[model samples]
Target: MLESLLWGAVAAAPLVLGAVLAGIRAWPDRLLGIVLGFGAGALIASIAFELWQDGLEQGGPVPLAIGVALGAAVYFTADRLVERWAKRAGGGAAAGVPLALGALLDGIPEQLVLGFGLADGAGVSVALVVAIFVSNLPESIGSSSDLLDGGVKRPAVLGIWSAVAALCALSTVAGWALADVASASIRTGLNGFAAGALLVMMVDSMIPEAQKRAKDLAGVATVFGFALAAGLSALGG
Candidate 1:
């Protein structure tokens, strides 16, 4: 459990770091959007190389399919509620919503995969660890920056992202505990759930926002991010 917690913290470390960096200076919206796109790209690699492949191996087709559908449904419903709340709150509250969603959606499963690997005695990959760092950094950075821009207090923004990072880190321990008892299908289902939620966030939140802000450069930034993170995954293999 201690090991799991430690490793989980390791994976989530970038979130806090990113938030801290976000406070160092006021960043331009266009640059922040490009960074978000870059993080989304890294997340894409994580979904493909880590979540989907592991899920396919563990649960086969049926459970993965069911998990994906369920995950999508849950996220969509939650997102609607979030949007309504954001509208009610007024101001730029909605701007940071998707980024927060992305962090929540993928953070759990991302660390859980690590926890499961630890439990299974699978050797941790240094490159994959770096890949997680790559994926998480810009996410928190963009989210923090967005919140600051949206009229959110800096202290509150710090608190919010910090809480998220803590939860994600704890999820590693949850996965570690679950691994001993969870069947292969269950593991796959969880992975599928993460993948499904992440994909949706990418489409509705990350990609569109990046495109809206960064315009033509969003695609280039995304591809650059993909190549970098994917290259890291390749090194792991």
Candidate 2:
């Protein structure tokens, strides 16, 4: 538990740090786009080589499929609802609620997988940790900045980001606790759930933003991120 907590903090620390950093400095959208593109690529490799492979091996197809479907549905519905609320409120997600949901949607599962991976006593995966950290920083920075621009006070923005970070960190402990009592099938299904959620997040949020901001550089950055993370995944394995 302690180990999972420590690792969880290490992975999630970026949210708080990024929020603080964004508050202090203004980032260009193009740079944020490139970073997000890089992160998307890293997460893509993670879903493919790590999450999906583990799910197929541990639980077979049925639970994995159901988990994936449920995960997609959950994230899609929640994201849409948030978007609707933003529309009603005045502007896009950035102006209304900020993009913290974007971070949380993926953050929870990554932390869960982190704890689950540790359950086998083989230690955590550096690949997953790096992917999470890289992805999280830009999202938090964008979210925090947008919130500030929307007239949300600085302290409130930090508090909101802090809350998200805390919840995401605690999910690691929850993952460890759940994994301890879960069957192989259950673990696999949960892994599939994480992968599905991540896929939606990339498609709906990360990639589009990257394209909008980074333009030609987006594809290149994504490819670079993929190659680096894939190599790390091999080494971690």
Best model number under lDDT: 1
Candidate 1 lDDT over 1-237, as tens digits, reads: 899998899888888888889988998878988998898899899888778877888779888888788777777888888889888988487667677777887788767777888888887778987998888898888878888888888888888888888999999999898888888887888888888888888888888888888888999999989999989988997
Give stretches of model 1 more than 4 Å off: none
Per-residue lDDT for 81-153 in model 2, tens only?
Answer: 8778877877633451424775676678767767777776767666657766666776777677667777778
Alpha-carbon local distance difference test for all models: 0.84, 0.77
What's the lDDT for residue 220 in model 1? Answer: 93
**Candidate 2 Cα errors over 4 Å, as ranges:** 92-99, 125-128
Clashing pairs in 2: none
How far residue 226's Cα lies from its native spot in candidate 2, in Å, is 1.3
Among the numbered candidates, top TM-score falls to: 1
By TM-score, how accurate is candidate 1?
A: 0.95
